[model samples]
Target: MLYAYLLSVVRTVAPIAAGWLITQALRLGVTIEPGPVESLVTGAFAALYYAAFRFAELKLSPRLGWLLGWARPPEYPRT
Candidate 1:
């Protein structure tokens, strides 16, 4: 549980970092300016994106692990 929780934090921070990276990229490529308000809004967007990603990952991780052969099946006793 704690591992998952911490992972979620990373999940949350990843989008924020990605957003900053995007802003940097856009600043380099285009003349569009980002204001303080937009930065705050982008932070919110990043948080939301992180939350959704975490939720989705939680929902899908088990299935993905099984598909990837990382999940082991339970052993059955012979009748």
Candidate 2:
């Protein structure tokens, strides 16, 4: 579903975005340049982290059901 796709994209991008912000902050105080290679590595690591997180969530869903309360309920369940 659209929601799932959006969540996946957010999860994948969040760490890379955070890394970029942190690097920018450090650059203000230090002479550090995260060039294209660093960006690519960061993005690759972010995707790996997202995949691991999603795998864990799916594997543990039964015990983590409470964390997923935001999902839509069955359409016919409510009166």
Candidate 3:
């Protein structure tokens, strides 16, 4: 149960963490001389971050909510 909860939280926050890291990296000093390489790297990182975030929200949100108490799990249908 504890592991499940922890995973849920991590899943929710992982993308944000990645995005923050990328943003910081970009802001601190992106001395990558203007070129397609810089744009490619930045765009790739942004896309990866967004994709992770989107997948987590779409696939794990309900489980996360239930695990974190933001919402309840649906009751199983009875026979």
Instruction: Encode model 2's per-residue lDDT on 1-79: one tens digit a residue.
Output: 6776797999989989998997997789965566966987898898787556556556755344334443322243322
Q: Candidate 1: give the clashing pairs.
A: none
> Cα lDDT of all candidates, in order?
0.67, 0.66, 0.70
Weakest ten-residue segment in model 2 by summed lDDT: 70-79
The true-structure Cα RMSD of candidate 2 reads: 9.8
Considering every candidate listed, which one attains the maximal lDDT?
3
lDDT of 2: 0.66
* Ranking of all predicted structures according to lDDT, beginning with the best and ending with the worst: 3, 1, 2
Over 4 Å off, model 2: 30-79
- Candidate 3 TM-score over all chains jointly: 0.39
Candidates 1 and 2 compared: the better one by lDDT is 1
lDDT tens string, model 3, 1-79? 6776797999989979998986898899865566977887898998787666555656877545433334644464443
Q: For model 2, name the residue pairs that clash.
A: none
lDDT of 1 by residue, 1-79 (tens): 6776797999999979998997997889955457966987898898687656555546766444344334543354543
